[model samples]
Target: MDIVTANQLKTKGISVIESKLADKKEIIISVRGKEKYVVMAIEQYNYLRECELDAALNETRADYQNNKFITESVEDHIKRITK
Candidate 1:
């Protein structure tokens, strides 16, 4: 990962990130010498989001296989979650 200071980002703007991203998948934004944020391309972000959904789907499948799921009405589901 490449680190960019907050000052550099402010002075140089998104171009600084765009240039670094040419060779890197992600860039870290540092504030006061400490890492505070990350910047990445939209494609990479979407890929990660898909990976998260896939993991959730796998977990749900496993739960179903183990008979760990419940059947309930919509109102009951809402009430259970809200509680």
Candidate 2:
């Protein structure tokens, strides 16, 4: 991963990020010498979000297949979960 200091980012702005990201997928932003943030292209962020949703969908399917869900009225579900 490429590393950019807070000072560098402060002075250089998005151009620095754009240049660094030209050939890289992501870069780390360090603040006070500690890794603090990550910068990535929007496509990468969206892809990750889609992957997260897909994982959740798969987990929900597995739970259903294992008979781990409940069927109840809306009021009953609300009461049951609230308790």
Candidate 3:
């Protein structure tokens, strides 16, 4: 993680963004000398997000494969709920 002042970021915004994206690095933008926002490549963010979702899906599939899933039918579930 790299930290950049708001002024510096505003002055060299495009170059900073390009460098971060090329290196797949994250930059923390600060305002009033306090950390405010993060900047990252869109592709990197999307790839990481997709990886997380894929991991969750794989875990769910593993649980289901291991018979750790609910086996209630819709009608039975509705009847039990109504009762």
Candidate 4:
């Protein structure tokens, strides 16, 4: 992880992005001495996003397998709620 000030990020946006892509690194952007944002390569971002989705999906599947799922479609569930 690399840290960059917000002003530096604004001025050198392209280089920062290129560096992260070339090195598979992440940049933490700071604003007023506090961490504000993360800069990562698109591929890395996508990979992490997919991993989060997979983890959520696995949790959902496990819950369903344990008979913890609600057996209702959206429409039926809504109708039941409105009744």
Candidate 5:
């Protein structure tokens, strides 16, 4: 990850960041020595989103296969419904 100060980013302008992003570069924008934001290509962001969805689906499938979902007892259910 490339690091750039917020002031440096302000001085460099969007063209510089866009050019780097177009080449699939990821930039970390720092504010006062702390990383505050990230810039990446749209394709990279979409790829990450898809990967997250796949992981969630895989976890859900695994949980279903293992019968890992929770069940409540009738007494607890009655208390919830009555309340």
Candidate 6:
């Protein structure tokens, strides 16, 4: 991880941030003495989102395998939910 101050960002412009983000990693942006924000490449953010979805799907599969889920037809689900 790398850190940059709000002042530096203001003075140096986004080009500096763009350079740092070239590796597709996160950079910490601090305002005052506190670390407040993160900067990352779009690819990194998308990859993380896909990874989160994959994790959720894996958990759902595990639950189904362990019989920890409910079963119903799509019409039954719609009727139950609509009620």
The alpha-carbon RMSD values of the candidates against the true structure, listed in the order shown, are 1.3, 1.0, 3.7, 2.6, 4.2, 3.0
In model 6, where is the ten-residue run with the lowest total lDDT? 15-24
Name the candidate, 2 or 4, with the larger TM-score value.
2
Tell me the TM-score of each prediction against the true structure: 0.89, 0.92, 0.65, 0.76, 0.74, 0.79
Predicted candidate 3 versus true structure: per-residue lDDT over 1-83, tens digit per residue: 77778898789977876776676567888899999998888777898899999999999999999999877999988998899
Q: Candidate 2 at 2: error in angstroms?
A: 1.1
The per-model lDDT (C-alpha) reads 0.97, 0.97, 0.84, 0.83, 0.85, 0.91
Candidate 4 lands at a TM-score of: 0.76
Q: Model 6: per-residue lDDT, tens digit, 1-83?
A: 88888998999999879888877499999999799999888889999999999999999999999999868999999998899
For residues 1-83, could you state the per-residue lDDT of candidate 1 as single tens digits?
A: 99999999999999999999999999999999999999999999999999999999999999999999999999999999999
Badly placed stretches (over 4 Å) of model 3 are 73-83
Alpha-carbon error at 28 in model 6, in Å?
A: 0.7
lDDT of 2 by residue, 18-75 (tens): 9999999999999999999999999999999999999999999999999999999999
Q: Give the TM-score of candidate 2.
A: 0.92
Best by TM-score: 2
> Global CA lDDT of candidate 5, please?
0.85
The order by descending lDDT is 1, 2, 6, 5, 3, 4
| Candidate 6, superposed: residue stretches over 4 Å from native | 71-83
lDDT of 4 by residue, 1-83 (tens): 77778787789877866775576558788899999988887787899999999999999999989998778899999999899
Worst 10 residues of 4 by lDDT: 16-25
Name the better of 2 and 5 by TM-score.
2
lDDT minimum window of 10 residues, candidate 3:
16-25
lDDT of 5 by residue, 20-75 (tens): 67655588889999999999887889999999999999999999999997679999
